[model samples]
Target chain A: MSVKYIPVQWNNNKWKYNAVMLASVFAYLWIFIFVTPDLMSNEGRINGAVHNARAFGSCAFLMLSVILCIGPLARLDNRFLPLLYNRRHFGVMTAFVAITHASYIINWYFAFSPSNKYEALLFSNTSYGQLSGFPFEVFGIFALFCLVILAATSHDFWLKFLTPRIWKRIHYLIYAAYISVVAHVGLGILQDQQNHTFTVIFILAAIVVATLHVMAALHEKKHGDPLAAESGDWVKVCETTDMQEGYAKIAQLTAKERVAIFLHEGKLSAISNACAHQNGPLGEGKIIRCLVTCPWHGFQYDVTNGSSPAPFTEKVPTYNLKVEGNTILVDRHANEPGTYVEPVPLNIQGAAA
Target chain B: MDQAQAIFFAFQIWCSIGALIALFFLTIGIDRIDEDAQGAYVFRLLLIPAILLIWPLVLWRWFILETERDAWPNRHRPPRHAHFWVAIALAVFIPVIILVSLSVRQTWPVDFEPQKLSLLEERKS
Candidate 1:
């Protein structure tokens, strides 16, 4: 009900970092385009330009995919949440570079056509005229359109105007954009009948990433049912104050909500045992940097917001905790907002909950 | 069919197949995943790249399979504010300029040797 993790000052540094990343990418593209010589013969130069644009496009797409992956990884593994914090920067920058590359291809294909009037437009439409009119280009154009939509909406103001849910739906266009770029590479480059190596590489890379996700998903399905994973209702195993130093204990709240409570640095923290993004149980993950990091996907929620340090993470609910006398007791009735559940402490010595 | 026609037909068919296969995998894969995993975070990561490779498939999946839970046409509401339009315009403008400049910079010069010019003319024709 209450928005727990909403901060007073949306981090200005985060926006600045995004701006710097985008500016740097633009600078790099500017240098590459201006400094490069046009010494290659007409066909040769055009081919070279397309090739360079594609290489840049591929890299941009890869960066965008990684940025998109960060939030899931953070929710899956809280240690990785930091990566999600800067994901928008990466997404916007990748969009910028991709736009540059898309424009280059459009120009290289259209600008220098010597055909007059109708003939030129007709020629451009022919298969041999514009990089063989590879359907990939059409898809590429469509994807670029999506990227434009996404990049435009990336700003916080637009996000607020659009509402997180609506803005989020539109942002999903990036997926369509990714597929378009892939088709652009696959058909325009791989299906070229002349170049197979790069196509194969792209296919392989895609296969691996897709496979990793599938395998992870399968693993979660097989072993990740929160309700089935534990015995009994999630019970408060210890009093809030009874948790000693360097300690971790499992609490089963309901069959669906299992948690691990940890006492570290004289503070008590609790978190969902299951990863928020992929359902990887936190109970099995390694704790690093005072956060429980999911082994699968690597999402990290702050032990305090169930909010990830990362910007785009899904929030996991944290429970209400109180210290009563020497005996540890947890009320199953009241759950509070913004309580970050810490991972189970590895050892029991010198700890307090 | 001639060689060019053959290539076009082949490329078209291949893309169509690729699009279909991508849709197939995405549907089955997405259906199998749970609520948390299917959330925007993982969906963006796993599906975005696949969509990049095969957009029609992704669009079909997004509109038909994914958004179907709500409804098709009304799944995405148009933005209400003038600022939303402004944002869209700015996005389009930035890319349009870059595209135009790149086109201008790469424009071919008219002056050239007559003999070699004929070769280009022949190629064009």
Candidate 2:
């Protein structure tokens, strides 16, 4: 929403999000180190820093899987949007946990290599031709670096600088990174590890992530655009009663876009269906007083003008409406964003008749 | 040095050169992404050594300009039902992977010398 370089904006939800994240991270690490060993002594293999490294890696992988699920989950239900607000924090956590794992690996197994640890990690593992012993470390390295880039640019400042489109494009590297991580785990650890627990968890996580994304996508398609309106300059919306009081009836535009025509206070005014923030559907939201309060995060705009009330700068385009007979005909041509358009009174249709 | 050693060192040289090119040439697009041009350049400069010294793999990855659209409208490719079938296909496909994986005998390269060496160490009071 902002183009200027402002410091990190904190809120109650963000504070709660960070605190919960920190608690869960510490709890996971504690349990992995202190409790997991006692329970799996029969099957447990590695110990000390090496074991710690794997534990951190596993935690990072789980974090990434959950992080990926949040996006599609939010799309599936507006109730999940609260989780979406502070999602970048989760991404940063994943990167830090992953780096911790990488650090431990460097410090432990490769500490006493014949060559320098890094050179040995790269040149010593030249069995790239073999599937079982291939250098899967390369994939992990790529994923880790991508995570670093994503974490670095997660700031709104960067979002403002890069433009949302480019920023989103750059962040699509997350999918690439996720794939690399999957390969890293699948081909590297699971191939030889005797521990079936990690294998089961990995498989389940993969299934859950893939399944959630598909379900979310399907949910969107099911509620897709209604049939296009008629071709004349003014398109006929539903009869006055179809749009309930304080509710909106979404109309499909010529393109794939939509407008939300809200019925409020015995009058009708239409606004761009997409919220100024993150393109959440405003049509699904309710009208409070005369403001259309977005269901996601409660960003509101005046239904009369499609402008944010006093103090807030955000705005949306409004459509012109003129009630003719029992039908409410709305101009397909949208007014400029934040421009005021006098709402059509309910009596106008009655008077015309 | 054996012929293998020479070739290995040569591969390392190529990796080093590739890394250098990726750093300095992070691209003009980097500026367009951020409003603060100086800040963007500085941040990219900080990334250069990491892009170089961390792994030679970043040499190529750092320069990748191709972008994938996974956001709304474009997020659904072939619709969600298509993505659903893909998920179902993967679900069906996984058990076969496990079955095949069970057959491959693993010869793990385990070096327990670190543990062995620590066994006789005197305990601190």
Candidate 3:
């Protein structure tokens, strides 16, 4: 199994990708530069701030879009991974532009116009400036700070310096950054009447991302150990003989709130109903080649050890099971690692009539 | 040239400076022909533009501007370091030029006018 790094890496295409991106951004920059009025007057400065902020927000969204697309794009075709591999650079660049956009706004409103009556009164003493004055700006600033950390630590040198687990945990801050950006867009840009179109678009983006997260959560609730949250470890509720030949019997045990121990091909397999990737119920997904494949991301877990076949794949804990003759009994408490156990053979006892 | 035209010319010169810097970095960073085989050609292609672009900026920084002490603080040998100073100067100068250029350009080349609902409306006499 190839151990592909999360966020991946690129070799030569990195240079090309950066070049194309920088060129496009500069080209747009030039186009805008030659058109917009100077920040000389009060109105011009405000407009400039708004323009820069919107551009930064849009750039951030593009970065998010690219990040979201990388996984699906890689799965669709391996060749696309090169683009996906260098996504960190894109993310960092996007954040830098965003920060620049945000800083200009701060400077325009607060620092630049300190002499003006409105500026001094609005920004100088009040918490409103800190809180609502730049509604999205604060979140945008936080997100950019996180992005800077993420980008700086993205190199192999940093990866070695910070262990993979610590790096992974730190990287999770991206989701936090996304949330902040969403908040920024919602509160900052949407409040103004001038940015109606962008406000609608940002809201729609928020809805979509939120919907994905909700769906993932619901999936976990349905299939994940009904018991693990309620109890400590996942419990085996039933045994092989009690279930049908092909299908596993669903039961709630002491630890695992709900479990399905399938007896297939004269083998006993215990699994939590939920999928790990998106919390899709394992019971709903088909068991193929002794592996339970998630309906969502198609993450496959080996029934024997409850670990994924691929590296960077995680596993769920499975409980101990026992067969007591015609009646199947399971020990929900004890568990042993790497002990290859088989499901008991079944005789159709009830459906004969 | 009059003040406006001179300014425009200066702007154009600045624009060229910005474009040159962008092109330089872009050429080095990007794979134009091929990254592996024609590595020497890439470097050679960069030389002419680098020299032409750097020479004037160097002169401006040293003789005309007299800001070399302030600008090139890291440089111990003032006159001799003109070439290196020019490259660094362009690098700093280019981004600001590009950003300012974005603000000055009032009209986007692409039509941003709200589109008509139907083709018939758009084609109306």
**Pairwise TM-score winner, candidates 1 and 2:** 2
lDDT of 3 by residue, A165-266 (tens): 334456666666766666555455444434244445555554444444444344444543333222334333543334554455555553223455766666
Worst 10 residues of 3 chain B by lDDT: B72-81
lDDT of 1 by residue, B1-125 (tens): 24445555564686676566656544554444223233323333333343444455334544544443533112112221222332343344333433332232322257854367788889999
lDDT of 3 by residue, B31-119 (tens): 23223213333333323332233334323332422332332111111121122332343334333433333333333246576555797
Best by TM-score: 2
Poorly placed runs, candidate 1 (over 4 Å): A1-52, A65-85, A110-134, A156-172, A193-197, A222-225, A228-318, A321-353, B1-125
The stretch of ten residues in a row with the least summed lDDT in candidate 1 chain A is A1-10
Chain B alone vs. reference chain B, TM-score for every model: 0.30, 0.34, 0.24
> Per-prediction TM-score, please?
0.46, 0.70, 0.43
Ordering by DockQ: 2, 1, 3
Interface RMSD of each: 19.0, 7.1, 23.3
Candidate 2 off by > 4 Å: A3-5, A38-44, A110-128, A230-240, A251-256, A321-333, A346-353, B1-125
Q: Positional deviation of A210 in candidate 3, in angstroms?
A: 5.2
Recovery fraction of native interface contacts for candidate 3: 0.00
CAPRI grade, predicted model 2: incorrect
